[model samples]
Target: MLSKIHNGVPFKYLIASFQHQPRPTFPRTSPLPLRSRPIRTFSVQSILRLPDSKAQTGSRHKFTYDAAASFSAKHKDFNAATHVFHFNPYNRIQTQKRPKSKRPASGQDAFFISRVGESNAVAFGIADGVGGWEDSGVDPADFSHSFCDYMASAAYEHKPDAGDPTLTARSLMQRGFDDVCRDGSIHAGGSTASIAIASEDGMLEVANLGDSGFVHLRLNAVHSYSEPQTHAFNTPYQLSIVPASMLARAAVFGGAQLCDYPRDADVTQHTLKHGDILIFASDGVWDNLFNQDVLRLASRRMVSLGAWKTSDGGILVADDLKPFTQSLAEDSAQRSSTLQSVIATDIAAAAKTASKDRRSDGPFAKEVQKYYPEEDWHGGKVDDICVIVVIVSEEGKQQAIKSKL
Candidate 1:
């Protein structure tokens, strides 16, 4: 169903209660409404190898889409890519001390590719399945991946107008939820969703379900960001709290199922300009690193790789992006950094903090063990982590300038 949000409405906290199911329980917190203060808002061949960095482990996949290449072949306007997209997705099952004989199923984080039906405009989303669903005898990763697939398809099907990104995000989530519900394999599972759509016009639309969120970086500072919906620490809002019929199942968790999920996502809009960077991540990253740390890590990479200099610390546009965008200048700063750099940096940060010894058998370690007792958490809280960084490509910006002429 299409849920409406009155612009400028004061933020309202809508807590959903879930019944226990013999698993971890989250506090009773309604889905954090997307606050309106938002005046804001792959290498093939190079394809098969993972990074050799100490920070990045687990399974990694990277892809780069250039509009000047295949995408532009279709639309003449795309002769120069209006934007370039790079993604580095990684996953690792929580490490176990004794380690399960058979890697206990799979890590529950899932990412969706946002391209379909002939336009360079695309969207990206990540879903992290709630650990509580393991009790249902179902692999929660299946649900998380399924939700992403459906959401991407829905975005393609509805094709919201370019100017109306808010609707584009909302429609994608609402319709994606409806599609998932139609399938019976996923009877009861929960996940957090953070998605963003960038159009040819340089407009970005974002939506968050639960604690998943995105942060905008410009001029070495976080210019704007999303507020996570959560009942307490570690428990963010989720798409599926519980089934309407089996609300009693959540009893063991202390919270009762309060509302249907996949409803209208807290949608926000932003006019993306050159030199802006957007970081979309799951709670695993935010919970572990401070906002400044996140930015510092990214900035450090940009500088070390020569993508940006300390004096002008803006995002770097890829050097050879002529394949991605048509009007890219030969002399502009070439991006030497890869999505792997950012993803690996985040995973390393989380691992370091989670593994940091308090010098005492602190309560933090106990909290980490309490949740993932079987896994060798390596002094770090063991949870699935995902990060996606989007930067305005130099070629795309040059194209924008040319178009204005």
Candidate 2:
């Protein structure tokens, strides 16, 4: 069984049998409001704090962005070419159930990328399954994977002109959580989510819950990042589907499940630049690597690939990103290997190495030390890692004019 230790205390859960129910249609209305819980704060003294930076100023031009994802399972070996996803806006949306074999190789960690209806916008994010549920005879992957799948399908079918409320990142997350709850096959499980919606006009909206998070980077500098919400050390805010039996057991046993709603998520908005980079990942990556570490890795790859250039004044974005974001040939064996994919793979590989290194003190290690000085936790935490990387590129003025003409 999967397990994690925090402050010399091993998390324990109550085991209960669950009853299966019939699946129902996806709910259009929001779930019943749940009271929010007060969370304890934990200081990240070892994390590198960076000043906020504005997006690079440039001429008014229409912009578009491309995305890719790379992941590595904690138990399996990582293969960069085989464990990558290149987002394609023109692909057909899946209406039926997705086959198990078609899922990403992220193991207990899950992610999704989907076009927003017929619009020129995209939605993507990551979800990390709470492993402690395994002790209750629940496979956490079922909940996290199904949640992402529902969100992707919802985004693909969303219509802006349908007279419905505007689809925000938090709303999308709520939709997914509601769908997962209604799914009879999920039984009982929990997960942490980080969701984002990027528009063609260069606006980004993010809704982060629990330890899974995201970071924004531009010109080799960290512009902003999301802070994790936790109930206490090693116990983060999570979306869960607890069975009635489990609830009854907890009510009698005086220990309740940590269930959080989508409304409890922290939402933030950002403006994108021509060469801005966004990285969204599960706690698996964050627990082992710092924000500055991610920025350094991405900056090195961007410069090496000529996506970022150095001039006398300052670092500049490439004139045209088509060369770097171009679609690969359909028949190519390694079609998933793109510039974004390379950067994502590099970051995942590094996190994997750090997780296995006994001498390297990662973010998790530092946090453990702060809480328990006498404990001998001295290395990175090994877990499933999922990372989605996005590259924003503004179309040239001439190209925009040509399209309009």
Q: What is the lDDT, from 0 to 100, of the residue 13 in candidate 1? A: 32
lDDT by residue for model 2 (1-405), tens: 324443324434333233221110111123422222211000010111111112432436555767888898876888876777777776666854466687777888999988887765789999998887776678788888889999999999988679767789999999999999988788888899999998767899999998899889999888888888876566678898988887786667655667899999999999998889999999788888888889889989788778899889888888677666653333465353566777888889988888877788888887666554555677777889999998887756346646787
Tell me the deviation in Å of residue 65 in model 1: 7.6
Model 2 TM-score, 2 decimals = 0.83
Once model 1 is optimally superposed onto the true structure by TM-score, how far is the C-alpha of residue 302 displaced, in angstroms?
A: 1.3
lDDT values, one for every candidate: 0.49, 0.76
Q: All candidates: CA RMSD in angstroms?
A: 14.4, 10.0
Off by over 4 Å in 1: 1-106, 156-167, 241-245, 248-255, 258-260, 312-380, 394-405
lDDT of 1 by residue, 43-148 (tens): 2111112122222212221122321101111011211111222332222212211122322122576655555323445567767777666655666666676777
Best by TM-score: 2
Name the TM-score of candidate 1.
0.62
